[model samples]
Target: MIVITAPTGNIGRHLLPLLLESAPAHGEELRVVVRDPARLPDAVRARVEVVTGSHGDAGVVDRAFEGADAVFWLVPPDATLAPDDAYLGFTRPAAKALAVHGVGHVVAVSALGRGTPVADRAGLVTASLAMDDLLAGTGAAYRALASPSFFENLLEEADSIRENGVFTDVVDGDRRAPLVAVADLAAVAAGLLLDRSWTGTDSVPVLGPQDLSPHDLARIMTEQFGRPVHYARQPLDELYTTLVGHGLHEAFVQGIVDMKRAKDEGLDAGATRTPDTATPTTFAQWCARTLKPAVLS
Candidate 1:
């Protein structure tokens, strides 16, 4: 049996269908831990066993991990908590359940910059790495999908781009870094979950086909949308203030600020994009398929 957590989330929503298509051929039974079973399609609900509750809940993971051979783990972001509590704390219950149930393999969504100079101080990224450590300590064969920011993150700026021809980020307009589509990340997770021959804890960098700067994204968005889209750099202080003012925890707000600072300092630049690390989707393709539709809608 293979178990998936947060099955209704961005990554899990994609990962679930891939597994449903492939796992049955491998003689694998699929299970999902979700807060709301209704969020799953009627067809999906018929195919998999559903354990309803927050995966962060000890009882929920205990029930979900039982008789499971591998798990696709993705923590939903919680802006109400500190970075450590948001990542490691949320996983602690599931980590314990994994060992107790003797589930052998786990593939988790994580960030880039594990060994880089800025990693220890990169706030949320640092917490995500620590969560990797906690899961590895459970003796499961773990692969953290070490990823940079997602192309889907731009979806948040759809309204801004539609109205003002602009999108915003804390990174410098010219600073380049790898970015992956969430679908690509989900595909990577599905691959690892299905093929569990690999052992030991390690990270797989899921960099997209090329590195892109904010300006490059703007140029591509302009081309894709047939509009004069532009990149706007937001101040780190302003981001923190805005997030906190929106009622997020102060520590979590600081964590976002620190992560943006680290990324600006080349934290995500540590990984080399080999064929193994590079994923297939290009930024332009993502803009055409995902962003343009979002902005135009």
Candidate 2:
């Protein structure tokens, strides 16, 4: 049996069908832990065993992990919570459950920059890596999908881009970093969950086809939309102020600010993408297929 967390999320929604399609051939029992089973598609709800509750709840995790061999784990983001509570606090219970139940494999969504100088200070990344450490200590075969920024993150700014031909971030417009599509990350996760031969803990860096700067993304958006889209570097202070105004926890806000600063300083530039790490989708392809449509809508 395989347990999936956050089944209605960006990656989980895409991953569910792949797992369901392959489960019969693999002879695998599939389970999903979700806050709202109603959010799951009818097809998914009909197919899998549902454990309705937050995965962070110890009772929910214990119930879901029963006889499970592999699990897809992802901690959903909650800006109102502290980093420790949001990531580590949520993961510790599940880690204990994995160890107790002896789950064979755990494929978790994590971030890159593990061994870098900025890693210790890269707020969200730091918490995520720490969560990986907690899971690794459980002795389950753990693969932390060490991903960079998601291409889908740009979608949040789609309206701004459509109306003003500009998108904003705290990083330098010319600083290139690895960016992966959530679909590609889901593909990697589903593949790992399906195969049980792998053991031990490791970090799988899911880099995109190429490194891209915000300027490159802007260029892609311009071409895709047939408009002169541009990248705007928001001042860190302004970003912090806006986040605070949105009622985000101060620590979480600071962590995001630090993460953006780390990116500006080339935190994600150290890793070289190889055939194994390079996901098939490129920024241009994503812009045309995903971003352009969202902007137009």
Candidate 3:
């Protein structure tokens, strides 16, 4: 059996459907650890064994990891806590459970810049890398999907794009870096979960087809929406202030600030885009399929 956590999230939503269609053919029984079973599609709820609770809960993970061969581990972001508490603390229980249950393979969602100098100081990314280490200590064959920003992140700015024909980021408009689609990340996770021949702890960089700058994204959005969309660079200080003003934990907000700073310093630029690392979806395609509809709607 393969256990999938956060099966209703952006990456998990896509991953669940792919596994649902394919796992049966491989003689794999599927299980999901979700907070609300009702959030799952009716058809999906009927197909998989559901362990209802927060995957971060020790009891929940103990129950879910039992009899599991592989696990797709995606930690949901918690802005109310500090970076280490949100990432590493959340995974500690599951790490123990994985060893106890002897779950051999694990595919986790993580950020880029593992070996880069910025990684150690990148706040949330640093916390996430530490979580990966904790899981690796369990002796599971772990693969952390080292990804850059997602094209879907732009969906959060749909209203701004629609109203002002602009999107915002903390990076310079000309700074190019790899960006991925959540679907691509999901597909990569599904592949690892299905084929467990690989062993040892390592990371797979899910870099998109090419590196794109904010200006390139603006150009693509303009083309896709037939509007004069533009890129607006937000000051890092302003971003931190705005997030903290929204009542997020001060340390958590600082983590966001630090992560943005690291990315600006080329934290995500360490990976080379080989065929193994490069995923198929382009920014333009993502805008057409995902962004355009959100902005237009």
Candidate 4:
């Protein structure tokens, strides 16, 4: 059995199909752990066994862990609490469950620069690094696929982009950071889970196709959407002030600002390490293929 958590998320939804397709040749079943089974799409509910429960539910984890060959562990983002607290809080529960079940192979989704000192003050990366540590100690063969900023993140600002003709960010207009598509990330996670060749805490950093700046993004959007899409850098102090005014917690906004500092310094530029020979989808391909339909909607 292969168990997946948050099977309804943007990444998970794409991953589950690939996972089900890649199931072991011996009639292995795919299981999805969801908070509300009824809310899951009809097709998935029918095809996969649905284990309805929270990530904190030990009984649920223990039950799902049984007979499971490999697990896709995802910590869903919680907007209600501090991001760090929400992520770290799930580590103990997950670790205890994996240990008890003696599950061998595992794949975890984590952020890039998770183990580095520069990203420590970036908040979520620090917490994710700690979570990866906790999982690694459970004696399960693990691969934490650490990724940089998500391309889907731009979707959240779709309304702003459509209305104002620009994308907003704290990083300078020319600052280039790795931007990955969730589809690619999910595909990589599924591939790692099926291969099961790697073990013992290997950090797979997926740098996407390139380190894109806002200016580059705008050019791509313009060509794809037939409109002038520009990059607007939000001043640090003003961005901080605006987020607070919009009810975002100060610490959380600080975390965002801190992350941009790393981007400005080009820590994410190291994505070129993924070997030039490897296959990667370019930003232009992403805009027309993924971002265009999403933006129009």
Candidate 4 minimal-lDDT segment of 10 residues: 270-279
| TM values, all candidates | 0.99, 0.98, 0.99, 0.91
Q: Write the per-residue lDDT of candidate 4 for residues 146-197, one digit (tens) a residue.
A: 7888878888778887888888887888877788888888888888877777
Q: Tell me the tens digit of each residue's lDDT in model 1 across 1-297.
A: 999998999888899999999998899999999999999999999999999999999999999999999998888999999999999899999999999999999999999999999999999999999999999999889999999999999899999999999999999999999999999998988889888899998999999999999999999988888889999999999999899999999999999999999999999999999999999999998889988988999
**Better model by lDDT: candidate 3 vs candidate 4:** 3
The model with the greater lDDT, 1 or 2, is 1
Off by over 4 Å in 1: none
- Please identify model 4 stretches exceeding 4 Å from their true place: 24-27, 114-117, 275-279
lDDT of 3 by residue, 26-88 (tens): 999999999999999899999999999999999999999999999999999999999999999
Order the numbered candidates by lDDT, best leading: 3, 1, 2, 4
Global local distance difference test of model 2: 0.92
Cα lDDT of model 2 by residue, 1-297, tens digit: 999999899999899989999988999989999999999888778899999999999999999998999999999998988888889999989999999999889999999898888899888888999999999999898999999999999999999998999999988788888999999999999899998789888999999998889999988888889889999889999999999999999999998998888878777877779999999988888888989889998
lDDT of each: 0.94, 0.92, 0.95, 0.79
User: What is candidate 4's TM-score against the reference?
Assistant: 0.91
Winner on lDDT between 2 and 3 is 3
User: What's the lDDT of the predicted structure labeled candidate 4?
Assistant: 0.79
RMSD of each: 0.6, 0.8, 0.6, 2.2
